[model samples]
Target: MPDSSAVHFTNAFDIRSVGCSGDPTMFEAFWRETGDAAELVIPGWQTMSYFSDVGNVCWFMEPLFDQQVRRLHRTVGNAAVDGYHVLVGTGSTQLFMAALYALSPADADQPTSVVSTAPYYSSYPAVTDFLRSGLFRWAGDANSFVGDSYIELVCSPNNPDGAIRDAVLSSGAGKAVHDLAYYWPQYTPITRRADHDIMLFTVSKSTGHAGTRIGWALVKDREVARRMTKFVELNTIGVSKDSQLRAAKVLGAVSDGYDVGGGGASRHRLFDFGRRKMVERWRMLREAAAASGAFSLPAETSGQCNFANETAANNPAFAWLRCDREDVEDCAGFLRGHKILTRSGNQFGADPRYVRVSMLDRDDAYDIFISRLASLK
Candidate 1:
């Protein structure tokens, strides 16, 4: 609960930290500043039932959570919700698996091929093949993948690299699942309302409530949504109702902060606070990368953000840092030797010279990381 604004670091760097995981602890300060806006209280007797809205395809999904999901989309103009079926999951990870299960053919002679562009999210391969399911198999990068039947994952403002992306394969026989977890105004500009067939999002990335363990998907087809819901049913019976309610409260609070009539617009807004923090962090990171002179980051990119009503830069949740030192072949190993833990780009189907650094750690850890990175020779 340390306020990021209050933490300061000197020339001396004493802290060594792990920022390999995209844990969004940076937004803790903003929620704390909001006081009781996002606070939730449920009666002990409530949420005891295993069923919620049995009429819906995702029977366990809370209606309030569903409503807030649409409302938030409308408020931010980040994704198209109209005519989309809102499906809930434990987190975006569960929904991601659901997309694979829902998209894969049951009668295929071979396991359906799943793919993404190079330098993709590392979890895309790990999670796809973890169960060793015969229904689908990870088929490496989409750029090199050659097949008619496939499921391509398009992560916009993609993880690890933050590149705005689209489906690499346009085969009519292939289905694409858009992972827009970081499409919020904080990470990238809302250039247009995303209307992909299957779009996955989570409270973890949007509101930095990773512990809430709640994610919702917007599916255009009823049958696909039904199949995705079945995947959730088979995976965990159903997601936690308490978590759904809590997520609903948090999302509602976010939309409320932007309500013009509610007068909450004058108060601290989540996206505003988030965007400010990310912009500042990206600036610091750029400065550090320059000072080190041994690393290079993606060039800054910006677009007119429909939500923020201004041009915004792509401030990804992770930094795709490439080591420029000719002697260093493995950037991750070099950083690890310096007591900085990061995921190597090789895991993302990219070069070993590059590493993905999490930009969402706590303020103290982030400051120490920036200092250490700047001092790296």
Candidate 2:
């Protein structure tokens, strides 16, 4: 098999409409080279039952799925799972809501305030208030929020800006849910093993399997796990067992590539492939920004990645581009006029001069985007 890490970029660019929804389809090439390492073929007769484990709090969680989740975490050294209870969700979005439901007080007179730092995940506020649930309400930026009771979302390598973050609110009454979705070595360096009270992760970001719609949460408290499980039970009954099994196979395959006893000669290491692509893409983006002269990007940051055992740059999944041109106040609009779609910074509670561009699109779309961006004066 050809080395998945070595990708060839052609000068040929296709001028087509691009949609940047954090869809991670770039990893398709890498997975394609892995043969059947991540493939799954589940018989129809299997996974027919609604129940997976009745004795466990998360009764719907398949054992193999649970095992693979922990195994991959252990192999990557990105999260601590020794004492955590893993709860599966339809997606991390469901688990995120579950965290809000589990953390908020049921007897409180007012809705629990949910806040994250400005330039937070656009979905956090939208998802929190969509139901208008009395349990929790979107409370804007955590930096300005003055409350004793709140659930703070700490998305490290934050969605819009990709900054390493922690809970902004430090009140004793405030609880934190760490969204470590992009903590994988590909996007950012694994500086430490994350050990938070409630942590959210998804196959979408981690393994680039967004179609699977599989996400899981690690809860330090059994009661919290039970409540989160209850939220999933009420919301979706249970996550799809087929998706879970496929996710398990994918995750296990990832671990296999690194295991000394298993597939030692395997050329399917996902992180190696991912890091190479991200680094190259970031280099291209920086060059584009420099060539444009009207655009700027966050200074590249680097750290000692424990997983890679070397200092590595934080090549974020999203490029937070700022249009410095005096006439352009809305970067998204400016990019939209150029046929390069991106999420506006205003939606992330920041200045309109900035926009969040997905760095994980297919080669043709990304090539077109960078080319268009570079041509802008």
Candidate 3:
């Protein structure tokens, strides 16, 4: 038999090519650079160790778990998680799969179509199909002919667009599941009085705590929560206890004003600073794209929406630009050659001329990006 390891199997389906276009955050690379030198976590997480045994029960986590759940709900004004009793998952991504399991019906009508707006989080379609075994389909745009009996996936301040969908104030409407992954006190205004259950968020984006792989789900129904918990129990045996403990510790410390001290500004301050920097970067890119006359962006920023007031008050953090000129074939590859990576619009079911630029980089790097993009013309 041939040596299995020498088959060069990666060429068959280069999974790395997916999500490979964008420039990863320096922080992520830095964290991985540590290479197990010390515990990868906030200072508070250093207090806890991953030594929990399997035989032990989850009784020790009752209080902290309750606190984390309540804090998430109160901050987001989404009572769905409170109603369902969120089960701690390995990460929000795991919760996402659990949600698919909870919502998907093997014998149901149409095999549970998963729909969302354009320029969505790139992983939505892949995760849905991967976890659902080709049962789930990416139905684009809830308003654009999404047949009945479909679950729409919505992301607020959406991954690439940073646009939040208009929320439905009432219950019993099965439009879609909203991913409030980036919704937080710092990024969005908390004017919510009604809780739209079926939302997922992770500490990765919110607290820069990606390594912990900690995430939470909010839903209004006990049945949904219980079902999701069941799925979690089957996958990875109910997450890691030590991860939970460390997350709880870090959350408590941060809420009580203890900084992670990760060589950046405080949580709120860092977010605020990042937000401002993103807005500035957006302007620079918009100017470059416009100056090149080779691209056009979505009108969401200038279009009518609840965030109209907010958009007017503040600049956007994402640049959803599209290349109208026929010369450009792959926006991502074209940008990559310039040493500036961007997400291809095709991945989000958008036009190839379109590219999504994340504005989360530091001001200096962002400036370099603007210069390079401007020179492309």
Per-model CA lDDT versus the true structure: 0.92, 0.91, 0.59
Model 3, C-alpha of 284: deviation from truth (Å): 3.6
Q: Would you give me the overall lDDT of model 3?
A: 0.59
- Superposed on all Cα atoms, the candidates' RMSDs to the truth, in angstroms, are 4.1, 5.3, 7.7
Quick one: RMSD of model 2?
5.3
> Residues 86-169, candidate 3, lDDT per residue (tens digit)?
556677888888887787766764666677777677888888776446445666555564445667777786777667675422
Candidate that would win on lDDT:
1
Error of 3 at 258 (Å): 11
lDDT by residue (tens digit), candidate 1, 185-256? 999999999998999999999999999999999999999999999999998999999999999999999999
Compute the lDDT of residue 265 as modeled in candidate 1: 64
- Structural RMSD, model 1: 4.1
Q: Which stretches of candidate 2 lie over 4 Å from their true place?
A: 1-17, 261-265
Which candidate, 2 or 3, has the higher lDDT? 2
| Candidate 2 lDDT by residue in tens digits, 213-238 | 99999999999999999999998899
TM-score of each: 0.95, 0.95, 0.72
TM-score of 3: 0.72
